[model samples]
Target: MKVIVGLGNPGRIFRTTRHNLGFRVIDKFRKRNGLPEFKSSKEFNSLLSRGSFNKEKIIALDPKNLIVIHDDLDLPLGKIRVSKAKGAAGHKGVQSIINKLGTKKFFRFRVGILPQQGKPQGVKKFVLKSFTRKEEKIIKRVVEETVEAVEFSLREGLERAMQDYNK
Candidate 1:
């Protein structure tokens, strides 16, 4: 089974914020694959759905393939980085998942949301704030690319995905 999880804070207010990029990516992937809406699961503390792609059993959630999609403050906006068995780098949501799962042996697709440089905003404030019109346009494209990367990872494997999508 391949599990894909997108890490994000729950609630309508956070829906379009930079911190919610993970959720956005999952939504795109689900819609592209013709899957039904994700149902909220208290057990997982996330929205979840199950389906198959290319004959593989897929369980999509907010935590454990557990593939985590989240925003990174280190990289420039719209950049995508895929890693495996890595540390959370101070991301609370990712840390929570790591703690709950008691392992970091899963794929992570990090979408960069940081401005290039010279921005005067704090990380917390920036991530929680809604994206500007320009950022949203970029995010729209990045989400599609992320969906493609996820599919490629599943169809091929993690190594190839990292090589092709990581930047």
Candidate 2:
């Protein structure tokens, strides 16, 4: 089974925040593909839904497969990054998954939300804040791209998804 995890804090308060981009993408993918609704699962510390892509079993686990998506201070908003076997970069959620999974060999889809200028005054506060109107537009596009990349990854391969989406 192919697992896709979107990383984010769980709850209604964090729904629209920048840090929840991973969760947002997962939801979009679910809807776009007409997958079943995500169900909360404490076992994975995420909202999850199961489906198929190219006849391959695909399971999306929120806060797990999308662990890499976040407000990247290094990359400008709307950028999509794919990596594998990398450190958590100090993200508590990612770190938790690494600890639970006992490995970092999984794929990651990171969506950037930082400004071109640089990180804001407080990193945590900035990530938890709601995106500006302009930022939201960019995020919407990126989320769609992410979903496409995910389908490509499942249909082709992770390497192809990385090469195609990690621009």
Which candidate's lDDT is highest? 1
Estimate the Cα RMSD of every predicted model relative to the unseen true structure: 2.2, 2.8
TM-score of each: 0.92, 0.89
Compared with the true structure, what per-residue lDDT tens digits does model 1 show for residues 19-89?
Answer: 99999999999999988899988887788888888898887533336678898877689999999898988
Best by TM-score: 1
Go through the candidates in order and give each one's C-alpha lDDT.
0.85, 0.77
Quote the positional error of residue 95 for candidate 1 in Å: 0.5
For candidate 2, lDDT tens digit of each residue in 54-110?
776766443334334444545678888888888888677777877877888777887
Worst 10-residue lDDT window, candidate 1: 58-67
Give candidate 2 regions above 4 Å deviation.
60-71
